[model samples]
Target: MKVDRVLLIAGGRSGEHEVSLSSAAGVLEALPYDADVAVIAKDGSWLLGPDALDAIDAGEAASGGHPFPPPVAWGDYDVAFPLLHGRWGEDGTIQGFFEMLGLPYVGAGVTASAVCMDKDLSKRVLQQAGLPVVPWEVVRKGEPAFVGLEPPFFVKPANAGSSVGIARVERYAELQKALEEAFRYDEKVVVEQAVSEARELEVALLGNVRAEASVVGEIRYDAEFYDYETKYTAGAAELVIPAALDPGTQETVQEMAVRAYRLLGVRGMARVDFFMSGEGELYLNELNTIPGFTPFSMYPRLWQASGLTYPELLSRLVELALE
Candidate 1:
């Protein structure tokens, strides 16, 4: 069956714009349609059709030399496959736009995106849901933030992703700098106790009600933490799929991953990250509503290794979104 419309929106004002574009590039190639890609540049611009990439390089929202295109009508496409990550795209802003336009875009809805984008709220919901999220405190703007929270905790923007403005403060002396950095991204900041000697594990959750968990994967970053550089730049870190763990522990991780997905009301797909301590205890990490889509990305790779081909995975997401 041919899909009438599938706009793969990528690039955004957020720090993860490049990652989003990389993801959109992959989705553009895999979508059923041969020529239906929309490049949403970082500067609040839109580039449609074949020359989207060139338009991106031209540093404008639209391709020059063409008449200004009016705002796209909602009915233009059956589905909008948004590849936007962080800031204006993922924080319910674009999702709200899609809702106003009566568009059925892929990924979590507005409420889910809003809650997930705000780390403090996400943790609170998880805590209320009887999930094991690290203890955290919210430091809103214009307040003394250095006090109250324990030292050696993670300082991150309240509503940011891709580890943007994230700081791993190992001491009291580092708390202020970390808070400043995190506050730069957003008015609010989240400070949580660092889980030392914990292994980073990630599980891909797919679907809505009948969510399925992919084989657990682990991230091994050589840096002090899995910051932005360690996530995108080559040689920054290594990813281990089907992370080696005892059968019982593996089942526990899988269960936690699914539970987190359900509690967040996440739909379509999410990458649930966890911090497995040296004693085998697992702590819930944040969820990625719009994860990377590169061919080598873990989201697709996890499914591929679990018997789902790349095209099949891509098709599954679109199908799930439409449903």
Candidate 2:
């Protein structure tokens, strides 16, 4: 694909705002082509060009840019790279906007983005596809109880990412408080059964219709669970690539990752996470449509381990968008 100008959109009102900024920085440093930068401030305003780069450098949280203008006014570019994570960014909202502007962008389309952003809906879809998923129950605010899931459950906002609104509840009594915290992020929440002594595994995916999976990776952490701090803090978690799994298990993980990626309608890229029990049982945890791109992020690192360099990966993604 012949490309001239690229529009890289980042930052948003989601809880992952800071994380998005970090990912944008990593992309900016390694992007092989000339690109225009656009930052969506916490107030839902837009920042363009050098101002956007300046905000990212200064770590500014508020938008100093003007309110979002018409798509034509955003400037002319060959394609857009919406690097924003969480809510409005990762959900179908921005994708739909790009669609209205008749612009090609990176990552999943509308239906896929919307479904994958909601944990409950995605789990249901995966289950319907005959995929093994961790048992979970959806709960709404003011609900009396969430049945079908036991204690030591993971309560999380169905629509947020980067562990932004997540909590570990060891007992039923603490469910309400955890629900309250999750509700702050979204109206609906998911209470998932925690897998015991399970190893956290991940697979990076690329391509559109015929997506390919990278070597399986493992996340070894010492925290109670992989929380927001543990995910972002330097040296907090160790990412093991080509996770020491037997050939059979590794093949199974790779196959499942590809299946899930196509099933969820994901394009360009994604990170498929899984939980493996000591008994060798594997359960699909969740899929990240816009996985982190920080220095410590597992997405690009998984591809790097698979022999794809960072700049190469960025160029390939742009080609995919143009494709």
Candidate 3:
């Protein structure tokens, strides 16, 4: 497909709005084609052109543009690249909009995006597919936060990303507080058993039907866990590409990543995360459709270690969307 003008959409109604703008800024700097920028403000307003770009560059809230559908002509762009993260953006909302418009957009389609955005649902699907996933219990709104799992649980919003609205609880008394925090972001919550001293491994996948996995990457962090703050804060965590794993382990991680991607119907691009316990048990953590494209993000860096440059990675994603 011969790519030309692109519509890059960013920001969202989710807590990851700022992070999306940051990622969009990186994409704008490296995107190889003529791209129009659109910023969806926190209040759900759509800002286009210079106003959108300026807000993304300034890392502030956008002021102008209409709501829902932007005032711009969508036919001018060849493809849509949604850089928005979390709920309304990454959770298949915008993807469906693009689908209705008969436009090819980057990342997974509606069903895949919706399923993967819900951690509890995605884990259930993974478990049913015979994949190794950490034990978790789902608690819906107005329900008792009763989990059979032991203490030291990671309570999180089922539909949120970037570790937002997540709490690590060490005792039963703290479970309510964590549940409350998680419920603030989503109706459903997932209480997952925390893997002790686990090494965070991530694999980046690209393509549609026959997806490819990049070199495994490990996240080394000094924080209590890889939370939202640690993720966006510069120098808070180190992403070690070609993670220090044995050849067999690396191969296993890559294979599992691609398998999960295919099983979940993910296409274009995704970052499959895993947790390796101190006892060496591997667990599929979660998969991120439209993974972060920021300078510090692991998805791009993983592909870089696997011999794909950043600009090349972006171009390939657009190509995959058209394919």
Candidate 4:
């Protein structure tokens, strides 16, 4: 299918609003087509027009004086590219909205978005499929308890991404504070046992029906952990494509990534994260349906390493959506 008019949606009411705008910028610069960008304000208003991209480029709202339309009116474009991350965007809300509008958008569908956004549910599904995941316990508001898990675990919001609200609790006494921090982002929190000598690795998956995994990439950071700041802040982390792993290990990571992608029913694109322990054990961490599109992000960089340039990568994703 030949895609002409493209509606690029970005920004949202989530904590990753600024980051989403940055992702939209990269998508805008790399798109092969003249895409009409739309910005979803923090209040959930859709700001769009020919000048929407210009307003987003200046980090300003396009709704100040422009006429904003509802999501149902997005049928003007042949395809839509939603770069909105976090709650309202990546969590299946916007995907369902697009589906209701009879609009085909890039990336996973409603089911995939919802299942992957919720860490607890995704973990259960992945584990049931015989995939190895980091051992963890779920904590609710007043029902917090660690049955068999030990301390020195990482506490994170079950529905957030990019390490928005994550904490490393080394002692039992720190559990409450960590849970509080995590609860700020989500109702359910996951406390995972820290992987010893763990190495952060990621793989980018693309396509529908039969998805393909890109070469694995490793993340190296000097921060205590890969927190939100370390992920977005310049120089806080370095991504090594082809991940310095042995050929066998690299192939294993890629294979498992593809398996998880297909099992999760992810259609267009996804970034699968893994944790490799010092003993060579690999654990499926989580999946990001609409990963960051910035130049430095691991998703595009992995595809670029696999011989797909950023612009070509964006084009392929749009084509996949149309397919």
Candidate 5:
């Protein structure tokens, strides 16, 4: 299917609002078709076109500052390419809204988006499917903090991206503050044992029914880990495409990434991250259904290394949505 008018949705009511806008900017610059822009304000107002604020409100009357019905009509475009990240956008809300509108959009569906957004649920599902995941424990707010694992553990919100609410606690004394910080973003928190001397590897997957994994990529950072700052700040971290892994290990990582993508029923695209322990054990980390598309983002860079240009990637994603 040839795509003409593309709905480029971006900026949502989430901690990742700025990130979403940046990603959408990249998409807007590279998209090959005629694309319209929609900005979802932090207060949940759906503003269409460049004059978002002062422009005419096309959505249903704001009911308590929440736009129940989106202003975008199904006939306005052929497909939607949502660059909204984090809570209200990537966590299945917008996906469901598009479904109700009977509009095809890029990335995973409602169920996959919701499931992958929750760390605890995604880990459990991956574990049940005989996939290797880091050993971890879950805790809820107001519950007795259980440092069941070792002191070097990571505390993160159950449903968040871009490392918004993540803490690396190296000692038991730091557990309380870390958990409290994590609880700020979500009621449920996850505590996972930190993988020591592990190299972070990521694989990008694309497709609807049949997925294809890109060449493996490695993340090298000077920080304790790939936190939010290291991720967005240019030069803070280096992405080594076609990660220097042995042939066997490279194939293994790519295969596992595709398996996880299919297991989660991810359509369109996903960036599957993994931890390669010093001991050679591979631990499957969380999957980002709608990974960042910034110039420095790994998802598009990996594809670029694998022969897909930025514009080509954007066009391919829109095509996947149409399919």
Candidate 6:
């Protein structure tokens, strides 16, 4: 199947909008040399010509502030690849819209997107399904207190990504400030028990059934956590391809990644994140259904190390969607 036009949709109603733009640019660069690439910016506008930098500076999109333009017509393009992360973009919203528009897209469908977007919900589903997730509590707005979860915890928005509104608090006194910061991006905040000496590991799972897992990659954040800066800012962290792990542990992590993928009904591709404790326990962190497709992104990097190049990976994703 040959794709004529590839639409890389980015800049969404989320705090990770800037990162989304960066991801879109990477996708454009990875497009097949023969395919035509079109860039869509924030504010539901289009970007053309060679001035990518100038167009990005002209407009910005904020959550609940950027109104989507008229829905895209079916067959406007061969496939819609949304690199947007967080809230409106990663959740079922945009996926549902495209489905209604009858457009084929790269990545998970509506139900899977919605489940994976909600941290609390996704954890519940995974844990209930016999998967391992960290201890946490979901605090809805207006609650006088968040309890049953230990302090020195992480307070984050339930739906945002790239750790946009995540805060690490060590005491009860700091809970208020953390929740307030988290609420700025989302009304619901997740207070999770901190995992000390925890290793940040991620596995890129591609394909439908018989999905393959990229060699696990470990990320060392220069910052406290892998926040927006650590993820986007140059040299904010170190990426370890083929994370050092015993063969047994590696196999378990890969199996868990596939299990999580199917449990959530993920389709084309997903990056399953995990925390490798000192005891060698691979705990599920969260799954990124529409994980970044950038060249430097772990999703592609892991695959590259696993013998697939960026262009080949993009080609596979397009084929998976249109096949």
Model 4: lDDT equals 0.86
**Global Cα RMSD, each model:** 2.5, 1.3, 0.9, 2.0, 3.5, 2.8
Question: Residue by residue across 191-233, what tens digits does model 1's lDDT show?
Answer: 8888869899888889988799888888898798898888888
Can you tell me which runs of candidate 1 are displaced by over 4 Å?
A: 55-70
Angstrom error at residue 127, model 4: 0.5
Candidate 2 per-residue C-alpha lDDT over 154-250 given as tens digits, one digit per residue, 9 for 90 to 100: 9999999999889999988898889889999999999999999999999999999989889999999999999999998889999999899998999
Q: Please give the distance, in angstroms, between residue 204's alpha carbon in candidate 3 and its true position after superposition.
A: 0.4
**Model 3 lDDT tens row, 1-323:** 77779999988889998889999999989999989899988888988878898899888674556977778788888899999889998999999999999999999999999999999889999999999999999999997766899989899999999999999999999989899999999999999999998999999999999999999999999998999999888899998988999999999998999999999999999999999999989999999998999856899999888999999999999999889
RMSD of 1: 2.5
Residue 56 error, candidate 5, Å: 18
lDDT of 6 by residue, 215-257 (tens): 9989997677788778878888898999988888889999999
Best by lDDT: 3
Deviation of model 6 at 281, angstroms: 2.0
Per-prediction TM-score, please? 0.92, 0.97, 0.98, 0.95, 0.94, 0.91
When sorted by lDDT, best at the front, the candidate numbers are 3, 2, 4, 5, 6, 1
lDDT preference between candidates 2 and 5, better one: 2
Deviation of model 2 at 166, angstroms:
0.6
Model 5 segments beyond 4 Å from truth? 52-68
Task: Summing lDDT over every window of 10 consecutive residues in candidate 2, give the lowest-scoring window.
Answer: 67-76
Q: C-alpha displacement of 290 in model 1, angstroms?
A: 0.4
lDDT of 4 by residue, 70-182 (tens): 54356668899998888988989988878977888899999999999999999999999999999988888778466367877899899988788899988888888888888
Q: Of the pair 4 and 5, which is ahead by TM-score?
A: 4
Candidate 2, residue 48: CA error in Å?
Answer: 1.4
